[model samples]
Each structure stands twice: as structure tokens, then as C-alpha cells.
Target: MTSSIRRIPRRMPGWAKVLTAFVLVLVVLFAGVRLAVLPGLRDLFGTETQDRSGPALLKSIQDMSRYDAASGNFQVVVDLEKDAKYLPDVLHGSRTLYVGAGTVDAYVDLGRLGGNDVTVDADRTSATLRLPHARLGKPALDPDRSYAVSKQRGLLDRLGDLFSDNPNSEQAVQKLAVRHIGEAAKDSGLTARAETNTTDMLQGLLSSLGFKEVHITYRS
Candidate 1:
């Protein structure tokens, strides 16, 4: 007598099969359009960009009186999302992942110094200076280096873009990024670093001017 063996094949679920077919169709369509139609269209009709804005007017210039003690470069990632109640993300929601690069400058306002802010000793061998604490400037975002890493929009959003002028606006995310960067800079000891640098600079300058003793203090 010989032994017999039986084998049973597994079948994929109906929903899974449908989902796989849908995904495959989308992929094929996207690939075909990207590899075939896009290049042909570009070759047939080359693209041209035009700038129609008027020449920039010269704005009023103000004299700067602050000493830039330290400049801090910062980067932040902003993830902004909006969801509709009881609606799936694919149907009515948006999410954006943005990477923002910016710079914050800490400065001391030398122009605010009063006549008595700096005092020289009668012997001309010692000096004392009173200066204000360093303040951080507004965050300036770098457009070249800052950009959206990824964006996901619902079907309704995509449909609305067809009629909207500014379809892809990153203003919300950009603002959030700037705010985060500013907060980070405040906690990064940037102001302390700036104060140290300013003190060192003033001390060196005064010493070079023949003052053997230089004392510097900052006002809150």
C-alpha cells in the first residue's frame, strides 16, 4: 500500500483582489501618461515663463544703529492638518509636511545708549559701559532652501483647485514654521550668546584704546 497526499490552493479575498486591481490600473495610467504623453507635449510646444510685474520702486532707507551680535540659523518641520467631522481623509481633509529654513538675528541697540552710558575713568586707564540686552529680530524664511516636503489633499480639495487661482498655498504652514523657529531660537541660548559676544567685542575695543580695565553691564 502507498501513501497519498492532498494539496489545497489558497484564494485571495474578493475585496483585496478588487483593491489590487484598482491600484494597478492607477499605476499603469500614471506611468503611461508620464512616460509617453508628457514628453511629446513638451517637445511639441516648449514652455515659456514670463514676468509682467512692474519694476520695483526704491523704498525709503533708514540708518541702522543696532549691533548684530549673533545670528542663529534655524530649521523647523510643520505638519498642518484639517479634518472634517465624520469624513474620511481621502474625501475631505488635507495635510502638509513643510520644511522651513530661516535666520534670527540678535542685536544690541547702540543708538539707544545715553551720554552717561559710557564713562571713562579720570586716569583714562579704566572704562565702564552700560548697554541694553540683546533682542531677537523677526524670523526671515529662505525661499530657496525652504519648501514643502509632502502634501496630501482630499478629493474635494483637488476638485476645488481647478477653479482656484492660488491652488497650492503654503502660507499657513510657513507661518507655523516661522513661529516654531522663533520659539526654538528663544530657548537655544541665542540671546545669552549674543550678550557674551557683545561684551567681548566692547572689552577688546576699549582695551585697544589704551584702557587697562574695561567693565560692561547690560540692562534688563
Candidate 2:
């Protein structure tokens, strides 16, 4: 009778065993957090913001001398990206998508009216007024309405934010938003509408004051 010999398997190396165990532990922890813990934590701490700001101060106020005849509401989506000269975006780049909402006012500077702008005819029944073209005011951004849709930062940028006081400042995006709003306002014919409204207002007022013929002209 031939005797059968049993061959034993080789044992794994200490480092290999340790590595395998560590990997398994990591997988289990990740699964636990993702499947169970995170949801509970998020429910317990919903996205609620608290305001702790101090009362607003009353600064010096200036009287407004312009008539806001027309206002244009505008919204813009800004996509900004930055990349390193020789590095890939994953390593040293950032991309942001922002949604901005604002308003631009078209006005006539009544303060700029000249003494000789209004001319009365000798008959006292006709008058002529020379006015400057309507001008657009600065873009006024609505803080409560404007918001960031998304933001992506590279590994280096994420690491740098750990030491930064204000990591997510929206100054650049906000400036871009204001610029876009201003551009849109310039092309929207808001100033022309404002001029028409102002002229109509003046005609009605002058006619009520017994002027039958009211002639209004705009200068550059």
C-alpha cells in the first residue's frame, strides 16, 4: 500500500497579513459610516443657519438727487475656472458656478439740470425743456437671492483652506456678477424707457400748470 503525503499551504507574511487586516477594517468603517451613521448625523444636524451679527450702525446719509424712472432686474450664471501653468486641474485648479441676482436703476439726474434748461414762451402757454440723457446706476446685488451653485477645488487648494480664515470668500464671483449685470443693463434699453417716463411725467406736470404746449428734448 502506498502512503499518501499531505502538503501544507505556506503562511502569509506578517506585513501582508497586517495590510490585509487594515484594508478590511477601513472597508468596514467606511461602510458603517456611509450606510448608517451619516444619515442619522445629518438628520440630527439639518442645514439650519443662525444669525449672530450685531445691530447695524447708522452712518452718515446723503440725499438722493436722481429720479429712478426705470429699474431692470437681472440674473446671471457665472462659471469661473483657474488652473496651474503646468499642473492638471485635479492637483492645482478650482472651478466655481455661481448664480447672481441683482437690479439696475435708470435715473435722470435732476440735480444736473441747468438754470436755463427750462424756457417759457412770452405767451405763457408754451414751454421747452432741455434734459440730459438718462444714466444707469450701479448694480445692486441681492445678498439673500444670490448664491453659489457649486464649487470644486484641487487637492492643494483644499489643503490650504485648513489654515485660511475665510476659505470661501465670494468676492471675485460677486465682482464678475456685478460686471455682467451692468453689461446686461446697458443693452436692455432701460435708459430709453427711463427717459420716456421722465418726459411723460414732466409733460403731465407742466400741462397741469396751464402750459398747453410742452416741448422736451434730451442732450448727450
Candidate 2: deviation at residue 101, Å?
1.7
Which candidate tops lDDT? 2
Could you tell me the lDDT of residue 105 within candidate 2?
98
| CA lDDT scores, all candidates in order | 0.89, 0.91
Top-TM-score candidate index = 1
Give one digit per residue, the lDDT tens place, for model 1 in 99-153.
9999999999999999989999899999999999999999999999899999998
What TM-score, computed on C-alpha atoms, does each candidate reach? 0.80, 0.77
Query: Candidate 1 overall Cα lDDT vs. reference?
Result: 0.89
